[model samples]
Target: MTRHEETGAALLSVLLLVAVMAVIAATALDRLTLATRIAGSAATVDQGRAYAFAAEQIALRRVGELVRRDPAKLTLAGDWLGRDFTLPLPGGTGRARLADANNCFNLNSLAAETAPGRLSQRSGAIAQFGELMVLLGIDRGEALGIAGAAADWIDSDGNDGPLGAEDGVYRSMQTSYLPANRKMADPSELRAVRGVTPKIYARLRPWICVLPVADPVRLNVNTLAPEQAPLIAMLMPGQIAIGDARAALAARPAGGYGSSVRFWEASSLARLDPGDIAEQTGVTSRWLALTVNVTMGDGFLTAESLIDANGGAPAAGQAAPAIVRRDWGESD
Candidate 1:
């Protein structure tokens, strides 16, 4: 109740106020620190995505360059971000790589229809298509039907293909599955065809492509995969053995057979009947499908490149592009 007692009470009040201020300040500091960390993490994720996008652009440019040159000279491992990698595409942060188109079936070739024996190359293409189906574990008859359906899809007319699914057959299905009257706008449309199951389509997706609706089918030997070598060989007359083409491939570079002409230049190709080599080499009437698989950290971008023996770049652009397909996974 005296002056000293009152002064003491005032000091206690000030001390309590200071303690409250200190506690509030500490809480605010903790929140600010957490907010900064969250912002930093978000920035890192966005940066990784941007790096992946840049890698895709680089891959497209490389594919365009290959098509400009010989499709055979393309390599995924050369000087990308100052290091080497494989063709299926380099897998790492801030990097993307591409795979050559020669490894896949040229979907455009499915349109050709000259009564069985007339166009030998065309017939060979049909057989090669069957071979591709076989590699995917499909039966020969089913392969033939699927290929024939594709033919019906591309040809201008409405006739049924030899295996059905032509206008008549497809139009008649009670369930109503059939070949399209025009070339496919997208490869996924193949699912609508009679024999192509989801499983079959998935197996064929990597090895086959339907691009640009306008592109033709020209098999690029330089881009052909080992499993697809036989199809390329079959496109030549005299039915070159799959075993021989595979052997010839072993001697070539890991990417592919190199130039198509170089593929013919190999002794193994020469071993085929002279007439067969003459028939296969230098035929560029068909279109070739070039797939550029660009993989960046945490992302995958695919570019479908169509090459003319003459030359040209893909129509796809550098922007927020629509994905034909994409997948993601944790890094090792």
Candidate 2:
């Protein structure tokens, strides 16, 4: 218990202090390294997003040129309908594809535009949708029920169709959510409607779209692929079979029909009664979608832009086609 003992205890204390300081320094260094890594990842994501946006602009410009070059007809003559291309960016790369977005059945068509900002159940469109479901292998009664439910969901009324549900019915469900009673902004909303099982949704996803308008479906016949022939068949239910529709599309001229009349005149489509469908078919597309994917370092970015080309010819100084909507994070 003398000076030696005191000195030994002091030495032990100094070693313990050194070990504690070393642990603290190590922990601080680890946290700094982690923060620096997180910041780098964020910067990389931002760069990728920037590249994706640039690619979208380029796609829009190309679409503008295409529409201006030929306002009357937009054909697959140059393989532009589903064109895939790539762009090189500094320290990254961008991939993009342009597609005719109006070739599918517009789900909003279930609701007819009676007047500006007014909507009602569109019986004809509902029938067509049901026909489409039947063509996709769903039972006819089930298809009609699903179509009625979809119409009720968007029709701006509380009265439900015979096979559909309204707010009262929805309120009685286990989950308890009311009908939107408005046009859907995305086709995914169909999942919320009654009778639309996940399996049914998967079957319908590829052939349906939710355009931003309640107008009846207007399909560009020239852009319809063989796989999309069911859309044509649905327009003329009980007349043109799906196989015949595909045959009609297969027989389409490489340069595309000069007009909807020529399209209907095709021998393969002669069985289709053009009743009101002629007004719904066209050679020009009104909507196009651009999907861009960017890869930067360890990050990835995806974006989709919906362009409405209903604007008159850009060559005439009318404002070029407008980008009505843009979505980031995922492409549908």
Candidate 3:
């Protein structure tokens, strides 16, 4: 080969080597930048979580003090039922709200275990639920069906109620699964029941809850909002109208009734016999929920804690209110 051609070949080889090195260096730098961002995001999330948990502790202490101070009743006089507060953190901020969690229908009330793991439908609760559904615009027949299905979902036996489904029915579905045959850990589980469509679930979400136990629902009359009059109406069905229920709630004393008896004795509510529900209804709350939201750097965290004050007064020198459950990511 000629000298000139040889020289050109050498230069081309050197250029190609430089280009390859440049590509490798660029890829390494890009990877390092991505790794740094991921590490930073993780750290921020951890910090936010720590702040959220600290806020929950503060809420627990406050609730304990309130319940201990006045064991007889919990009132809305101080606007404490749905109180919201904010806290300043070193490099972020936290927001929290406290709410009475028992002022809703308990879906678990539809059935209670007659024997260990054996559940039987509670006619009264099912009737009340059916009434609530009807008041909410659901067809009466469909409402009863949903209630029956809900009961069957929690019962231990394979037998289904009149309008309910069993494991066999579920197994035959396009996407198959079996009934829980157990108490629901959360209200969202209702979405899995046979008759609860997404729309129906959304409609019912605001007025119902799932307590761990299957005992009858005990709504705190003192905390019921005027907008929640349907809950009161459902309890007695034909006896009370929604407007009357709302008016009664609106007329409640600022500090709440001195006792459940006083609540039942109110002029507007006195005429109707609360009957079986009289024992189930009360003016004191047993459960409260605290929602905490924390933001740190670019990270955000949300958490909810369920506080069980054991209802009514704690024995003298009893331990502080207990946090029975905690959940992250969403609020119910």
Give TM per candidate: 0.57, 0.91, 0.92
lDDT of predicted model 1: 0.54
Root-mean-square deviation of every model: 10.2, 2.4, 2.3
Backbone clash tally for model 1?
A: 11
Error of 2 at 159 (Å): 1.5
Clashing pairs for predicted structure model 3, backbone only? none
Sorted by lDDT (best first), the order is 2, 3, 1
C-alpha lDDT values of all predictions: 0.54, 0.85, 0.82
Per-residue lDDT over 82-139 for candidate 1, one digit per residue giving the tens place of the 0 to 100 score: 1333343334333333443334556756654354322112444556676678755787
RMSD (CA, angstroms), candidate 3: 2.3
> The CA-based lDDT of model 3 is what?
0.82
Model 2 CA deviation exceeding 4 Å by range: 1-23, 312-317
Q: Write the candidate numbers in order of decreasing TM-score.
A: 3, 2, 1
What does candidate 1 score on TM? 0.57
Off by over 4 Å in 3: 1-4, 115-118, 311-317
